[model samples]
Target: MNPVLPHNTLDQLFLSARTHFKWLPKPVTDEQLHQIYDLARMAPTSANCSPMRLVFVKTAEGKAKLKPALDEMNVEKTLSAPVTAIVAIDTEFYEQLPKLFPHADARSWYVGNQPLIDSAGFRNGTLQGAYVIMAARALGLDCGPMSGFNNAKLDEIFFKGTAYKSNFLINLGYGDATALFPRGPRLDFDEACKIV
Candidate 1:
């Protein structure tokens, strides 16, 4: 078997994660996006309930639908991105927990607990979304994960008929660093970490 990326590889991912507004003329094919999810779904989820949903907006109409939902600054990059994934949470994620956690009663735990469901949905699904960003970078794709979009507008435009609702939007593609801002500051290990 081929070797996996080393510890430094993770640091590379951290280093590489940044806002990239400028894009190259490349297409992220449907199969490629599918492969990305197939690889990412392997990431762990709470009670095996995969609440995170992805909507790859590739067509012009889809991008147009997304524009009014974005804040003024995010409008252009999102439209230019090869693909924009509408990351969302499935409120009825328990329905799938049966299949995902066949050996356990994870589904019942969430059946009527809306608060617990909401917490689990947002927290766990956000983790899953983070996993997708890393998985995409591992696959040699650059990501511009942003949160300037209007969630209400997005939910109406993209999730109106579905139980799923928008969490955030991610612009995916090959990026041009020539247009990137200079690397910003970061917290040192001592400043951000604590061990008991």
Candidate 2:
């Protein structure tokens, strides 16, 4: 069995990690982006139907294209971050199940099922987006995840002619602690879980 992770590792991945709004001037390198994906992609997905696709908006042109889609509250934070990841779901993810889940005819399972296709794509894709945040944190980066955006507009700008659909955005960089708000509270186990 795998041993428990060290305390520092756990802290980095969850406990001490904060959703950052403001970023330091430091840049997140391309190498770091690649490394984040290499770590995140190993996480499991149903039928290995890994539908998540990412567009790292780092350049000025890309950010400008993205700006018009953002809600007023998300505009400045998104623009200031070193990278904003467009966490998207590929609607046609089942096409790759033949290679990703070769042990069974997984691709055939969703071929004609529109509802299954939509649900599975969104579910697994959202999970992958969480993995991306953890991976970034493990690499000592900060994250600001948000859903306040016009998804259709973003899809038009970045994913035109592709099957990918935007689910959310994650601003990534070295964060400015001075800009943080108070940490919010969480529910107790009793409030959120059951022993059944």
Candidate 3:
């Protein structure tokens, strides 16, 4: 069996991690982005239908294209961050099922099923987005994930004529902890779970 992670590792990945709004002007390299995705992709997905797609906007021109799509509250922090990842879902992700899930003919299951396609794509893609965050944290990077943006506009600007649709955005870099607000409270397990 795999060993439990060390306390410090857990703390880095969860307990002490915060959503940062300010960055330290350090860059997140392209290699690090690739490492994040490489690690995240190894996690589970339904029928191996990995639908998540990412667009890392690190260039000034890319950020400029993305600016108008961001909500007012998200603009400054996102623009100032070293990298902002566009977490998206591929509507036609089943096309890769033959390669990703070679043991079964999974592609046929969603060939013309729009509802199933939408449901699986969004759910699995969002799960992968969470994996991305954990992977980034594991690699000593900070993340600020937010949904306060115009999805339709972002899709048009970044994914026009493609099968991809925006789900959320994550600003990534070394964070400015001095700018963090006090940590928020979480519900106790008793309040959020059941022993069924």
Candidate 4:
């Protein structure tokens, strides 16, 4: 059996972690991004569908292309961050299920089913996005995740002629703690959950 994580590790991953809005000038390296994805990909997904695709908008040109899609509030923090990851879902992800889940004819399961494709793709893809955040935090980077961008515009700009669709964005780097507001409260376990 696996042991529970230590307190500091729990604190780093959840308890003390904050959604940052401002970033320092420090750069998040390509190696670091690769490491984050590597860590995230190991987490579970339904039938291992693994539909989440990422576009790390680190270059000025990429960010420029992404800028017009941003909501008014997300522009500055996004542009200033060292990297903004476009977390997206591949609508045709089941095409790879034969390779990813070879024990069964998984690809055939979604070949003609649009509803299954949409629901599983989006749900599992969103879960993978959350794993990305945890992996980033585990690697000592701060994250600012948001969904305020124009999805259609972002898709046109970044995913044209592709089956991928934008889901959300996560700005990444060392954060400026001085710019943070007080942490918000969470609902108690009784209020948010139940023992079945």
Candidate 5:
């Protein structure tokens, strides 16, 4: 069995993690980005169908391509962040299940099933996006995840002629704490969950 994580680790991963909007001028290095994905990829997914694909937008050119897709309120924060990751899902991800889940005929399960493909791709892909955020936080980076963008336009610009589809965006960098708004309250367990 696995040992429970200590307090500081728990705090770093969840208790003190906050959604950041403003970022420091410092950049998130390519090496760190790779490390974040390396960690996140280890997380579980159904049938090991890891469909998440990321496009790290760090260069001026990439950011320009992403600009028009952003909502007005998201424009400034997204542009200022050192890196913005486009978390996406591959509609044809099952093509790789032969290698990713090779022990059995997992690929056959999704080959001709449109509903299954859509459900599994989006569900597992979204889980991987959450893992990306947690992995970034564990690596001492801050994250600002947003969905205030035109998905169709973003897909046309960034994912044309590909099976990949954007699910959301996350601005990544060292955060500027001074720019954070007051933290909000969370629902109590009684309000948010049921203890079977």
Candidate 6:
């Protein structure tokens, strides 16, 4: 008999995942942050064209720099968190398609179409970003992901002349339940998904 079988399950974890976000009791160490990236990078990406980039802001300077990028309502929260990661997408992800999906001429599919490149780059990068969130949870870190900031402003401040662009920002640390609000509702699967 084969030892491998389809016996994995995610229901228990999914069912319990309520964005409750009662943060941790201690700090999120630098070593642990490195482990999160080590796991997040393993997830699949389009043609291996990993478009995502992470700017981990933990030092006082880095965190302070991110403060101006947030809305007035979020600045204090972000500043309080132990760390914030700038999740970004590489506009030139296609340049790595050959290395990621060498089985076919995947590079040609995006080489000429600017729109197509943007679409795939953003899509896959976003996917990876989501993966990072889940992995953070799996690794015992609380996450507060937000996309309310200005993308152009982020590009101007963080990306500068680089090909990478910020997709969203995520605050990672031990939650301070003292400030946590009630859990938000979510649509049921039937309402959100269709079998057809």
Task: Give the alpha carbon lDDT tens digit for every residue of 19-130 in model 6.
Answer: 4234554688888888889889899987788899999888889877777778887777677778888999989888887887889988898888999889888999999988
Window of ten residues with lowest summed lDDT in model 4: 94-103
TM-score of 4: 0.99
Tens digit per residue, CA lDDT, model 1, 35-66: 77988899898877889999999999999888
TM-scores, each model vs. reference? 0.93, 0.98, 0.99, 0.99, 0.98, 0.86
lDDT of 4 by residue, 1-196 (tens): 9999999999999999999999999999999999999999999999999999999999999999999999999999999999999999999999889889999999998999999999999999999999999999999999999999999999999999999999999999999999999999999999999999
True-structure RMSD, every candidate: 2.1, 0.7, 0.5, 0.6, 0.8, 3.2
Q: Which residue pairs show collisions in model 6?
A: 23-174, 23-175, 24-174, 24-175
| Residue pairs whose backbone atoms clash in candidate 1 | none
Better of 2 and 6 by TM-score: 2
Error of 5 at 120 (Å): 0.5
Output the lDDT of residue 110, model 3: 96
Candidate 2 per-residue C-alpha lDDT over 1-196 given as tens digits, one digit per residue, 9 for 90 to 100: 9999999999888888899999999999999999999999999999899999999999999999999999999999999999999999999999999889999999889999999999999999999999999999999999999999999999999999999899999999999999888889999999999998
Model 1, C-alpha of 171: deviation from truth (Å): 0.3
Model 4 ranges off by over 4 Å: none
Q: Give the 10-residue window scoring lowest on summed lDDT in candidate 5.
A: 12-21
Candidate order by decreasing TM-score:
3, 4, 2, 5, 1, 6
Global lDDT of each model? Answer: 0.88, 0.96, 0.97, 0.97, 0.96, 0.80
lDDT (tens digit, per residue) of candidate 3 on 1-196: 9999999999999999999999997889999999999999999999999999999999999999999999999999999999999999999999999999999899999999999999999999999999999999999999999999999999999999999999999999999999999999999999999999
Two-way TM-score contest, 4 vs 6, winner: 4
| Residues 1-80 of candidate 5: C-alpha lDDT, one tens digit per residue | 99999999999889888899998999899999999999999999999999999999999999999999999999999999
